[model samples]
Target chain A: MQSQSDNEYGIQVYNASINPAPRCPCVLLLDTSHSMSGEPIAELNEGVKTYFEEIRQDDFSRFSVETAVIAFGASDQGVSLVMPFTSCARVEEVQPPRFKAGGLTPMGQALERGLDLLKKRKREYRAKGIAYYQPWMVLMTDGAPTDQWREAAQNVQNEARNRKLVFLGVGVGPYVDMPTLTEICPDNRPPKRLQGLRFCQFFEWLSQSMAAVSRSSVGEQSVRLPNIDGWACVEA
Target chain B: MGKVIYSFGRFFGQAIGHVKAHCPAPGKDRPWCDQATADQMRGARSKTRSEPQLVFDRNGIERRLGPLMAKGGEGKVYPLADHQDVLVKIYHVRARNGDRLQTKLEAMRQMRPMLNSPLFGWPRLLVFDEAGTWRGYAMRRLAGVQMQTLCQPQLIAERLPHWSRREILKCARSFVSLVGKAHRNQVIIGDINPGNLLVDPQTCEVRGIDCDSYQIAGTTGLHTCPVGVPMLMAPELLGRDYSRVRRTFEQELFSVAIMLFRMFMLGLHPYSRTYGEDPVANLKSGHCAFGLGAGCRLPRGPWYKIWSHLPFRLKDLFIRTFRDGHGDPAARTLLEEWNDALDEYLERLNKGWFDPHLVPSAPKSSHYRGSDSGRRKGTASQGSRLFRKNA
Candidate 1:
């Protein structure tokens, strides 16, 4: 355990109060439903790796980037750290943990899990006296969830709408209702489509954006975002 | 009062050794002189010393002038000499807290690495002292008049009754270039009001001043952060949290747009029309100038009339930059737009449309002497209280 002033662990005590590192934590909630079994899965995995690789190359994203991966459909594919944000040098240092595809798409469970993780991290930050910006939860799906997702989706939507989390949803392939995804993300609109093989592009943006928020000295604003042009296509 | 008096006493204490070694007092031993009386005597001797007498002074520097100017919020600005003409800014520590001082000083220091010849002429910092109880610094001084005085209707009529279109645009471009330089360097001068900018009469050059609240990138390769005055701060910087990074080039571009709007429209803020009953409350409520009836005149029906005279896209971008730049920092104009608009504006200005010198204002030479020999009360307390040397 590092001392509060180490700044890496987000604990920063000043004038008798803990001044925590103001970092933004981000999670990529992916849908590996049965429909996404073959090429989509392979592309998604490659895209995920590419996301890590691309994010580390950015000037601002290196130290501030943290990642969590939660994939639905595969019972074994529980939410786990694709790459934990620490004082790590490169994203590749942490191997991209593999997620399988088998069960029904339980997006609610995945989203709930992702939110829980973010909440836990936030609590940790608060305990350590590190300040943090709004955490981002990005949901990507190919099909609708099999579980009673409305309640979970509504909960997620409420949190996102209230800005409790910076929520973004991306609909990929076909069968996933874009309008439904949009409804889930009322505050920032709904899931944008992964235009072409643009998962890399979206993740690249995510990494850079998170890094921008992270690398900032604990009290900076979350502005100057990367242009949304090259990433996901907004469903007009 | 006690702290000031204590600090004043300390100021003399530090200077005593330097004073004795370099310039001896007029009367060595005046036993009848009281402590206050002795302070007055020492203060006079410290002000004016022969060249050789000043050489051996600490670090070969000498006092150039006593406290000459004081702004309402900012502290006093004094002219000093240390092989160069410099302005010493002494902040009233009591008025500003430690965190604020730390924030301001750190932001200023972050810009140090990127300091080159700024287009609007940035004064280089010579020293930054937050050690002990007080905080202050010495910086290069620019030869200029306050922009606040220049555009005043009364001052304009008396100073230069007829400013040509070309001179006005050239001066406008000069101001833009300076702002452009700051953006390029990843700095945002949050206080972009006219009162904070200085203009040189001889060359019609502009320089940014009162930079204690400016923001820049952290020195250790951290993200670009936000800093500076909240009033002139971009919406994003002021919203949600205080940023330690510089506002994006896009946001800076928006600031440039607003600055130009003020310059061209005769110093009117876009939202000034609604600023009647309570401006502060409106600002807090996120109400900016865009579509309000009177304040919108510049960019709306009448203003767009003038804007239409300019190139299509450039005018559109200018309006969009400010309009979109209104409530959200995220939606501001990018650097590409600013650079393009600036290029267009410069080309237009260079075509003999405006005369910068003709802008209504007193020529700097009339009121501002490069060297103002104001009769300073030569007292030890005054001299000591004037500037705090960096440790």
Candidate 2:
């Protein structure tokens, strides 16, 4: 026994109820080249899972943290968008895809793809009038790029300098070139070297940092990041 | 019924057998009597290791825990076996230091007499583990949905469609009364948000939960409520280190004003606009869409139309709270003033100034289609102006 107006109002009310919340988008740019095979790949998988679990537990982050995982050197395409941007709640429901390291490192292609996806997502947010934090691109690798990477590094530097995105580069194991990571990351902050295969601790810090960002008012000058002494050492 | 009688003797250890004789039949006036008896029997028989349990002592009173009802960032809430009216909250093992929590709980117990009113679920019993580790405390278990469910206007509209404007007004009045009672007791509800209040839809009764977190005025050396929800926090507290700051009554009043605005406006936050994407930023910048001659006004839609139906006195208070008092915490509306204004609004509604159902007018044009373009155009012009002013 509902009238036309009542039905229309119901739809409007429903739309209002499901209004878009402010979003904190994070892109995980992972390297799955042959060097990451064994313990490194296993630990990285566990870390990603832990990251999702931690984000899901936070009430605000579950709705606000939109995550996308893109892996390089894991597929025939050189780089693969393993998971598109999804809320932490949805990420928790799906079993994270297992990474098998076999191909050559295509870090530049992966970085470019991650930046492209983040920019596209931001545009969608603007079109839909959704509020967002500066998107985060976390690049973790253990080896040098097999493909050309100067342009990708320059793109990251430009975005980071403009305060358009937060680019945190992490070099894993002794084989990683720390100097390259510094060049790729923003000038204000240098890249950090992961201690041992401590991917779990690293992701835990990332999750906590994202939670802090999502908690603050959007468009604030800077979010106070939690202490990162647990899993990282400044790359010398 | 016979099983309950037989088990009652074994459960209460014969002392309460005589009381069982006076127990009424099922579905009678004293239904809780049967429930209590059943609970005792269940307690005596069940010794399952899988079921989590905690034991705690308040003064000399010992309370046995039951199944967990809910869990949060701080602790787990379990119903008391013998007492149906009370529930025990056991804090997580890593919550602060044991001695500090003990001191805080003891202070809460001292404040019990003033907080015994029905509006509060104040801490009544201090709980501990087997090794005397200070865990958490017990308080009254409020039976109802969280006020958060009704914080938004759409939920209220959909859930309580039959409700008139009078009923909604009554709900707001109940909320104000609860806050007034706490203030009278000299307790600052540090984290005042919809999640912390429980509302019984049928009776319009509002009860404040998480009383353990309330800042007791003069409890020296006790751990205070250190944090607040960002959305509910006043502008001054937004970017500061909250753990170091002691929240005052004036700061709490700011949150109260925001809550009242939300309740009266259906779920629309005074700072919320279709164009403005960040609510926290809007609050900090004092961009109240409903304020008079404001640059960023509420989108011209159903919500704006509904605003016209509000009583002028209440509207004026909202403007004062969000606009004039936006920068200064002391300028916000006081609890007593809110109580007075809401009471007057209720009186006028009773006198039939307008029908509540008639106030929520359906949009003439589809808001989704028509308002979006207009809102974008408005945002392009007004948004820049507001940004410049704020800067």
Candidate 3:
């Protein structure tokens, strides 16, 4: 048996009270490729920081929402779990990894890794018998996938269709392949194109949606998400 | 950072902060000055700061505002410099030109009769900026714990650890009574969520805040509440374009039922279950697990453990409100009915008719495992049977 001090995904397993409330796991799969070096990368950093701040302010979401950050195309790691699943309250204590965008977008590898992390987290929740809302996978990219992505898209489709998770695809700029995003998030809810560099508004909407999900009883009813008119628009 | 700088200035600038001077007017001492000394000092220093001071004209009497106390989606609430009991909410630039916002504020200003109740933090005066720009209004600040803290099970368990089922029931009663009083005044609490209510745990007194958002009946030219919190909205309102639909008393009643359910049922939402992934889907489909129907069984855990302790009449009311009234707003339980049921239940508990100690524990086998044998044997079993038959 593992020791009491053992940690899973950077979280201390023995600290049961770290997340005594029901959990809402959210994985942010971001593309930090060469195309996202200057303003795009800076805005993305600010947006993620704002998201954490907003979640921490909410009393329920602070304890319930667990966020993990996965970045692609930054280094040889291909897909790096820069930040593991940590409660919103504790996320502020740790410094987030700064991204210096370079290399190609390895979207397939990131999706596969994100899925694996979510599955492992679910297993942990089950082992502890902790009730949880369906996990959320948010994919944001400014370019097309430069690697084999068909299998990863299929996996996302299966999970979304089974109602096991919610996948929201956000095309950050005009360069993103809208068709692939539609294929990856194929739960009748099409991917939305982020209007301008409204990363703050997008993250605000995500936090609000997470708060709604965390407030409700897990596994009972579908949370009605807030209107996305503020940050997103239909692709032309 | 600003507060630290202000504190340093106060301690050093006033000669070790021991400067005691006589009242400005001789022989007429300020009784409230002792408590307001810090505020006066801050007021003195703020004169040099560049932060904009909001100016409010309350019935021809102008009041200058201090710093912001809090901010929300619509506006920022600032304390009135002259009035200790009042706070002015100034609409942000985005909300300044909102449709019919002024007419709504005007309608609220005319509601003097309903303002008599302490349970409501009703708007007292219409306000504007120095340039005659339509800002927002002023209202009495409620001093108590947020209802979000009281209604959330985890917060209640952590902060108010001594609270029991009796106290929860008392809180529920107070909520229902407040709703009833608001309804009597022809005001519909359109945005009926935990954030809009505040509770005093010691006194069990419930006060409804954000009274300006309520839909006032028969108010001409008033804009209806165009938005609602999805979790608290009625099932019929779900998935609909909110801007096209005006909220009614029936919708408010549905929200009241949801609030009462969360309070008495340990924060379990009426439509929440372990099987579905989407609450709005469950609500739209009328798939409340706690109600009467096939497969309508309460989820296992703390909720199931203490459910039997609830009085039968209240259980029936829950069933009626959640099940029968799931789609039909007319079938929903009235606020008066909820008030009476909660009041009677508390009365019975106070009279020693119900034994608090006998409230059963969870069975050896968890209900999540689908072990029917572990189900309660008395009122719960009968209630489920009645629910099935009625369905």
Candidate 4:
């Protein structure tokens, strides 16, 4: 019998049995660039690790969750493939993959690369006859793109308008313009500010939301996302 | 009720909902959504279009091969094509999830001869295609039945009892040479029981099979299977301890010992299975099921008592391998007794001293002839013989 809760997540992880539907693929476009050095970057990096570890601990999330991190700091030229989540054969194999710091925040390149990775993973899921939800791109940045970023922002808006992907813009630290970020979304209030080193908390919420979405059968959606309280207040 | 006060909670909730409904703040959206989505969609479409086609039917493979023409693990062997009998091995879906690609790579890399000599009867790898979704490999099917069935003591006693002991030695010597060949090629035939070795009854030729479990040098790879035959497996291998790789040569020799024991003693698996309800359960218990049989009761001088006849240094090798290979696979090694015994046996067989009890053999039938231009000339003899034998 399919319980309503079980049906909510696109994946079911019970007794180490992972049932994954090709519902959605999510990538975290992290700013491991030079400007995010010291406390800001450490917290951000910690947040990224928390996202991976927390997601793996969840029974349902562990199955369907295929996470990729695109770091765009030191190698500012373009986004490089960090890890393909599909090869994590077992829950024990899923560890918080490490990343090094020191480079220009190439947010544009990271966005471009993250998208490609999600697409590749999604193709694999479909090939295996699994279903998927809308793919997601969670962009975490602290400053304006040192490289050309306007075009990348436009790409985000277009994807959001088309409902091709669910774009979440998170601006942490100082110098993040809310209006410019929200312009990346067709809908209003698209950009949100990071309350503190609470990026980890936000990732936890994101992971839970994804898990909830995957548990449900095809077409069923998740409502009542956890309250974005101290971790992240809705951007005014 | 005042309208402002009454609707305050609903108004605040709706406000928060409206805010949550929109996108979060964003500075770099250009490629994030548009370029990213486009790149992903393109990559996805290309991969989906380029999926590999299956050559053999997944379900039909096991049906043809059946439950291991002999005892084996969960995966079944299937014939891929009749062109000189190409066999494709399909790993069970459950087993497929293991580190198959890693295992295959290790198998290919480690099959090197440390001393750089010729291997006796090792099969050449034909194709290893991991790109295809389902894990499979195609290898040329070697000639002969599993040594276990072919060399059964009862069957040998019935069919070849009149045969001299010297003739048996030559057969055993050939097996030693085969192991030597495998070691020379850098392949550790991880499992060396009679069940894995195959031999042509008419030609007395032998070849090793089931190379998937074979590991490369430096790797602590051990063959995992549904139990029942742990007696033949080195103790360290059974436990899968990496320290056993240190006794690489000795461990290999231990396998040869077990193989020799099965052949010379006439089909007694050095250790027996518990005849348990579940064979896998018994194997996991890692203890010999049946007691050592009568053939091993011989005293000194006879090679059956070769352990005692062995030199102090060599005797210890056999003792360790015979004793520890199963539970402590690292402590065992291939003993020197095998080469010495094999050499002596082979020498006696070639001298005509081994042929006395047999009647003069009848002339073999003339082989069928065909146009020699295109078809493999010798393959037909081997292929047709196997097909007819299997059929």
Candidate 5:
């Protein structure tokens, strides 16, 4: 039988053969407003599915990456944490929720939900004394937020600026409020405008980038990410 | 991940002779070459060289390209319209510096040792655009389930359900031998990773792909492997420029060790079990956790059990390499040492000293009873593939 040995921190990591290896958690905060009901939602679902499929094929990404998905702009007028953080190793069991676009774009609430989930996940990591990479939040939206976002924006600034998180804001379509998205992002990194409805390329880049980062061993020096030019368009 | 595109110089180097001239279309006169260009068919001057539909092989056989098959950061790969078995890898035309890419390809083309081997996806046909600009080359397309699937537990259990310790070990040994063949030819698979290899599920025969990235020593000069992943990089090559450094065999062996470790230990990076820190840091510090064993903070998992179940000598080989080899290059385990250890392990397996269980969920570690099996003296260490009747 698999037995637990006392960890250096002396915490009881209660499990057998299920010891969590170092993890890299990333939360994808997506916009599913009513305007995205048709082609946009279909394309977005395909893209998210492609991301899972690509990460499933990669050994490094398969073993280490943990993904949670959160959606905003549902009928409830609040954010829905669609999927909690699950190991990519359990890829077959984990499915990207079939998102149906409905109501107000509560961008602020989604960011808060993503941040809260990340915080809780990090606590679990620390409790087990498990090593982890800085968390990543990829926020994609096609339209402007309907609610107040100043607190979420400030939290993103602090988390990203303090190096606790790698937050990226992606403007999905022409209707996006670039200024608000920029305000939410850190100063060094600006929100990237997604070209057309190329959600497939964006998620491929995300999965490939995560694979590289999770495989990377050092804290200093940034890991080289896949080129963003494929999906991100130049801002006018 | 910079986008690397080679510039096309006006001049074209002399093409090497083709191994076989593919007479693609029997009745059609030279397919791409004999067919009048759209401009010729139209009887008008071409529009800025137009799209290069025709590419000339070394034997001057002009071939037509089919629809694009696959694309990557560097370039796109296409298959010959008539010759379905042959695929061509063409670089993107962002051409900044063409000479280096040309020189590297030209040099590699001259290395004939890789020509007949199915083990490597070596560039076989030198393909040039109609303008005589070196675009890319063609190779026999290899078909197999990518080794990445074989490495992961969940995937392997589903894909190769019949795989056990014997199959995994046999595959690993075959991979080592293939790399040995490449090394003998002075070719170093500079970016060694599971992603770059393909495995035949039936025979567990591993085939290495992405030959363009190989570090090959040409008759003219050394064509250095320019790019590498950090996880596969050797210790001394940590901060060094991959383009400038000439990788030694000993250094290359370290990466071999890493890949071997992943294959044997269910895809765990040697440094991964580091008590909540950067795993690669152990590579730099020369303080690998495996050597410490019971003293180290090895979490309760299948990996720990595998380590515990590993034969003592094999564990020592890994320890010496990961821990001691960090400081001294010579301390790293060599291919022959691996062969020896594997030979012993095979014997132990054959004699039923241990169970032939290799899955991650392999039960708690009491299988190693090699002490009772007793050591076989003077067993010829040449690639031991023999298995006992009962095993």
Candidate 6:
């Protein structure tokens, strides 16, 4: 057990609090349903690693982006916080709990979990007086939700519509309920279909987009992210 | 990280040492400061990579770039295949302010002789492509990791293993001295962020990089520094068009204060709350975390004891600068004043006055008689819990 004397906030909190650049929180809501078991799961894991490295490469994003990973598929409760919110400056655990795909897809429950956590985090930031950019929640799925999700979907849509959240829904494979995902996302920023299993490229674009947003100066309008022609196939 | 090699670049008459960038093969995560030893690494590198990259020097002479040394959002830094001591910074194609960059670097090129000191990495000569289009400029590659790397404990332990608060103070002084030098030459380092300053751990000598963004009062016109890190900017400059608003020396002084505070206080922004508001917003609201009546709490980290340990003279300046100086740029402490305070602090530190622990422990309470107190206790295990410094 290390003493709190060296840095009173401990390692994790210190990493977050040490750099007082405004926070940019990103929540990754993943679909780990049984349908995603084979190659899809493998690609998803690799995509995540790519995203982490991509975000780390940018100086601003590395300082400002705090990310969390939540999956909905295997857990009895239908939602698992695979990774808690961590500052990109000191993100570790690159591999482990190697995302074994199983169980039914509870997309609604996971959305609820991801949204609640985001709300809690923002509240903490407000109470502690930490300034923050609008939060981002990225939803990636391959199959339809097996649980009651209308209410949670409504919340996601409402938050995204109000500009409180920057939501990006991605359909992993052909079976992904694109209509449902689109319903949960805002119209201006609709769901994008991943080209094949190009998880790496999608993650690369996500990281780039996050970085662009992080670099915007105070009072600046929305950032125009790099073109998504690399991996995403946005529906007309 | 292993088999270290130190290359000394000539700076004025002094030696500025920088560690080699250890790029066995240039991957994505890291690349910076020095070369991977020499040309030998390039012979092995070029074959496995894409076509040899090319650029044109100021004389329109074409040259191939060696292995990349560093890549950032704005541009990439690559070593010249021919010039062993020089590196080139090619701005990214999407540098939105590309027009401004060309004009500014051109204006700055005139001062190359005066700003010859490698400490500033001043552009030695402009570079162009075969089409005679401007590409970037050649500069003497600097030695050292970013000063921002030292601002955090984990990164500090990784890069500067044996560093103490004494070294931080030294770097701050060196940084201030460099800024003072630039100011005397009518150059304003408008973007004063840790990322812009590189520090050599071996010599504690700091070199200022990103000369392009420096605001210079050129003979033609005042070349503005359009790019700025919002958190580091003075209150007056926040949310304003950097290209339109002129940066005064007093504004630079405020930036210097923020840098000094961050240096002494473990990277905590002056406007930050423990779980704080963003520094930019705090600055806009005139709510500094230090200073009396700022209604800000000291960070839970090693900030308070470190704040308490600073000489009262320096402390008073920080308090006054953040509290009263937020609105009036002229009210900020002068660069010379900082130099004087740093001198006193360093002198007292050498004379065994006051606690100099990197994570200095706070005693019960007492009268502080300035640096003459010489109350420094030897490095003790005061708060070494989870922060197990591998050293």
lDDT of 4 by residue, A1-236 (tens): 44534323111222221132223578778777666677877677677677777566543455556777677775545466666654222556666656666777677777767766766765654343334567778887777776676776777767767766778888887776566666654574377888866877787678657655544323323233445664775655
Per-residue CA lDDT of model 2 for B250-361, tens digit only, reads: 7887788888776665545566654565667788887766654665445433554455555556776777888777787778888778878878777866765433552355
DockQ for model 6 equals 0.31
Give me the displacement of residue B11 in model 4, in angstroms.
Answer: 74
Cα lDDT, model 2, residue B18: 32
TM-score of model 4 relative to the true fold? 0.35
Report the C-alpha lDDT of model 6 over B172-204, residue by residue, as the tens digit. 889888898899889999999887888876678
lDDT by residue (B189-217, candidate 1, tens digit) is 65565656766544567777666556555
Assess each model's interface with DockQ, reporting 2 decimals per model. 0.01, 0.14, 0.10, 0.01, 0.18, 0.31
TM-score of each: 0.40, 0.65, 0.67, 0.35, 0.76, 0.82
Candidate 2 has a TM-score of 0.65
Question: Which whole-number lDDT from 0 to 100 does residue A222 have in model 4?
Answer: 28
Each prediction's number of clashing residue pairs:
34, 2, 8, 62, 2, 16
Ranking by lDDT: 6, 5, 3, 2, 1, 4
Q: What fraction of correct interface contacts does each candidate retain?
A: 0.00, 0.13, 0.01, 0.00, 0.13, 0.22
List of clashing residue pairs for candidate 3: A219-B273, A220-B273, A221-B278, A221-B279, A222-B278, A222-B279, A222-B280, A223-B279
* Candidate 5 off by > 4 Å: A1-24, A32-65, A73-77, A87-92, A98-106, A122-135, A142-151, A158-164, A172-176, A193-234, B1-53, B94-97, B293-295, B360-391
Cα lDDT of model 5 by residue, B1-391, tens digit = 2111121110111111121243233225332222212111221111222344777765456778875665544666666786544677888776314678667777776666675576777776567876777788777655445665554565565455566777777888888888888999999989887767877666777888778888988876898877676666677888778889888888888888888887777666676542445555556665454654323544334565455445567767777777778768888889888888888877876776655666333423333234553332112111011101111
Question: What is the Cα-based lDDT of residue B223 in candidate 5?
Answer: 83
After superposition, candidate 4 runs with Cα above 4 Å error: A1-236, B1-72, B102-131, B157-164, B218-228, B236-247, B269-337, B348-391
Q: Compared with the true structure, what per-residue lDDT tens digits does model 3 show for residues B1-391? A: 1121112223223312222231122113432233222222321221122444866463334567866665555666776675544667877778766647777777776665555466787775667667766678766655445666654554654445456667777788888888888778777788887778777655677888878778776467535666577667788887676656777788888888888877765555666555453455666787776754546344434455445556668888887877788878898998878878888888877764443321234422222222223443455565545433111
* Highest TM-score against the true fold, candidate: 6
